[model samples]
Target: MSSTHAVNKTIQEINEKIKKGTAVVLNAEEMIDVVRKKGKVQAAKDVDVVTTGTFSPMCSSGVLFNIGQTMPPTIKTSHVWLNGVPCYGGLAAVDSYLGATEPAEDDPLNKVYPGQFKYGGSHVIEDLVRGKVVHLRATAYGTDCYPRRELSRDITLADLPEALLLNPRNCYQNYNCAVNLTSRLIYTYMGPLKPNAKNANYATAGQISPLFNDPYLKTIGLGTKIFIGGAQGYVLGAGTQHVANPERNERGIPLSGAGTLMLKGDLKKMDERYLRGVSVVGYGTSLCVGVGIPIPILNEEMAWFTGVSDEDIDMPVKDYGYDYPNRLPRILKHAKFSELVSGEIELDGKKVPTVPLTSYTRSLEIANELKKWISEGSFTLTEAQEEIPSN
Candidate 1:
């Protein structure tokens, strides 16, 4: 059977089973076995949904707070700082955005500690979610109705009536492998890449990543429900720098940059275990986020996509020694996730070891938990309100 051939099922049919509480749902790990044993046709007929998951450090994550009005002399905030990290205060008088990678005022990047953003935004957000006090400072332009020049206070999550984890880019559809071809070691967000391709680091859950299963964003878009940092979340929009249409493989999986999702969830409902503040040595700090998405097996095509294996998913390996942030990276080679996960891959006729930054074990746990949620009727699949951009 051709891989491109369409499957014989409809979204309405899947919704009917969901409505009747008769839908058959499986996690990505479970679907792998089912597809292997029963084949795609039979598996598609048996499964109504497949849940996918990933837990990795995403620097593009952030939190938004709607702090209620202050005491007398209510000020229209012009400058806002949370735990000494400058937050975006241009929204409303009481709104701010605390970015994950935003550094502290005293620890500004310089020649001494270049790119080392130690302890600032992400930590403050974590503290707030954990019900700890965080120092808040704000300066405002006085107004007749809300007259105050400055205010300083310590606040907790309870002080804010509304707080949300609004990450612009949470789960990447696919990512490139980082390898060091030079003689010296390289420090990167993907962890440390050894010299001369001694070891390669890739950050992805492979078969269980949300966007990996729905490479084209077919069934994932605005309003899709997800498991974010161990709490229920929703896809708000296409994430920043979301590469819509990209080069794909024979299995229709993206070879490189593809779709991304902007997720929003209640911070109060999140658990600290799934939302840890991580500081990469020599690099900046980041928030390790755990995200899971239940892909509705609306049709056999969707089922087939969920059944994609590591061997079928190919990703490019880039030279981390190159100026990746400022310029396009030099692609050293292209290898499948299976090859990368095998602990070794051939690069320039030499075998190089590899490591994974994302935890497959945690990903499996999240997927299985989500599977239980769907089976127990605690969670239901949601249809995307709009198709994600393909640009």
Candidate 2:
């Protein structure tokens, strides 16, 4: 055969192999019908609750935590556990599981779950993490800005067991994620900590570090380490110091408090527009900001203690608490639970190690569908085709 013909034959063989590889990996689980994406628990029963499909954001949920200060200036610690574990542990757990090999038992976060199917709470995992329970407080001319007592909580993986046997068929069908914040430092860009300062916050370095100094803070950074969330400056507004003149008194202008001073450098980042607000935690001695994700606000005392920078993506805060906060409660008692496990693995009196249908698997299947959709649109690595149904 001619050299050209031989080359063409070799090319054909290579193309055939590529097609075979893409066809299917028999070992990998295949999904049939699933709904992927985040959603809210719309209704509740005993075993499972319903939520909107990925196409809707009405019920999407996220979380945040305050790591800026050791103790918030004026905040309180109220209900600690809200269905899940501490904010820091949650992040660490998810990252660990995603990066783990067969989910090792040695991982510190592995003990967070009581059983494979149980949800995590602060009471079970607080002892394993480095954190404190203190109240935070701050004042605007001696007046409290926002007041809400909260408990700063954390947790680890020894908390959940069911993760190993994740429902496969419908894994991505519906969204069910638990996000957490850790010492992972996100980078930020800002002019300086103090306004009109000739020197930068870090004279030698231009960037802020991700680690906070607080013992509760999990990640550790050096040199350029800056905490993620914390209040930097007092809102400043100035008025006449003394109205000694009779004309000033007649005008009803006795004087104004020091002008509100907002630190111009750092900006707080939140998940949605609704989560723009600050809360007092650590028993009312600290202040940290929280967004709509319903993450705990770390007291400013902690933020300052950690030397967090405002430019970090993890610390974005909405101005004037102008945005709405996540209204979803940590645990909606009204949520329904379908497919309640009978512990015997028997759905209607048949012995089985596992059930065929599971919400978790359905959620994963949905995610795969969305991935296919992205690839189909030629927006990803997959060949161009058509959009997959996200609903």
Candidate 3:
């Protein structure tokens, strides 16, 4: 067997082939078919890169805005608001962080509107990115050098020197399917859960997930370029609560939550369709982020990893009805994405329908789009500047 460091050599070979117009690249879906027809050995020899992608509701997301100078008498703002939702004003006078799930201060729990977070931080960011004027208000104590007490203005993304969607946590490697056994329906970020185990809702892009294809974080790390919301982006680091260690099957696929990514991209270049403002019933609002990462087929092992089928990826089914304050929910059973996508799974001797909160169709579109970019030389792979933590 070749040393794992062969990845560097493979990168050089791919670059040389690209210059000669002889490189072979494929998306995750197409690579799966090729592997199935020709086996991993031959497929690895033919394919140089495989693109993977996902589109899921990421709650631990936000945007950082560096709103430029406020007219004269610049005040070191102590408080800031974006579309009625309070933002982190601790950064400098004109910098703030707008969280995805943060509701307006007047309706913290969505009491008045109940689930329809009409003007939350995510919506404010979306409006600004779309070139719509967004309400911005700030208050500060008077200082000798900067003595402006309050300021209010309408601003678009272009008005800010830096408007970046820096999501601390976006796509998760794998997630559990949630089911409620209680008599009443419960709404959650995982989607609506029906009573009496009537339905199951899950959120993940199964085999097409970027971290899943690169479970060990071999090639995906800091500085890796990616397609984010139809615009180019890069990996910042390991996402918050990134579980470097998790129970895995024989194929090294995590059974549940595992790797995650912290991504950042220019909001001004993002498309509104790929960055959507979502309102979950009873749950707060969030951003459905579309992310695509191209995995360089460094070797045969990498090719096999990217070609993993949905049926081979297993995740647990957890009962959301159970309350576990300090512990995790008891795993009822395991089911594959293929089983969930089939629309049903057998649990406790009963057939229960399944619902996917993430859009698989959109995920495929992103992967194909990324593949086209690489094939046409519009996008090129970059080696990770820093490796991610595996432990």
Best by TM-score: 3
What order do you get sorting by TM-score, best first? 3, 1, 2
What tens-digit string does per-residue lDDT give for candidate 1 at 1-391? 3253445766667767766778898888678887887777777778888999899989999999877785653878888998888999899778888898887787655346877766868888778778889888999888898788888999988888888999998898889898887798878888877887899889899988888788778888888888988899999989998887788888888778678889999998988767878777677778988898988876677777899889878988998786576678867778999998899899989998889888898988888878877777777777789889864
Identify the superior model by TM-score, candidate 2 or candidate 3: 3
Number of the top lDDT candidate: 3
- How does candidate 3 fare on TM-score? 0.94
lDDT of each: 0.83, 0.19, 0.84
| Worst lDDT 10-window in candidate 1 | 1-10
lDDT per residue as tens, model 3, 67-129: 777467488888889878898988977788999888787765556655656557777767776
Each prediction's TM-score against the native? 0.92, 0.18, 0.94
- Over the stretch 315-361, how does candidate 2's per-residue lDDT look in tens digits? 11111111112343131111001211222222123432212122333
Off by over 4 Å in 1: 1-21, 71-73, 107-114, 323-326
Candidate 2 at 379: error in angstroms?
5.4
Model 3: colliding residue pairs: none
Candidate 2: segments with Cα more than 4 A from true spot: 1-64, 67-364, 376-391
Give candidate 2's whole-model lDDT: 0.19
Cα miss at 208, model 2 (Å)? 42
Q: Give the range of the ten consecutive residues with the poorest summed lDDT in model 3.
A: 1-10
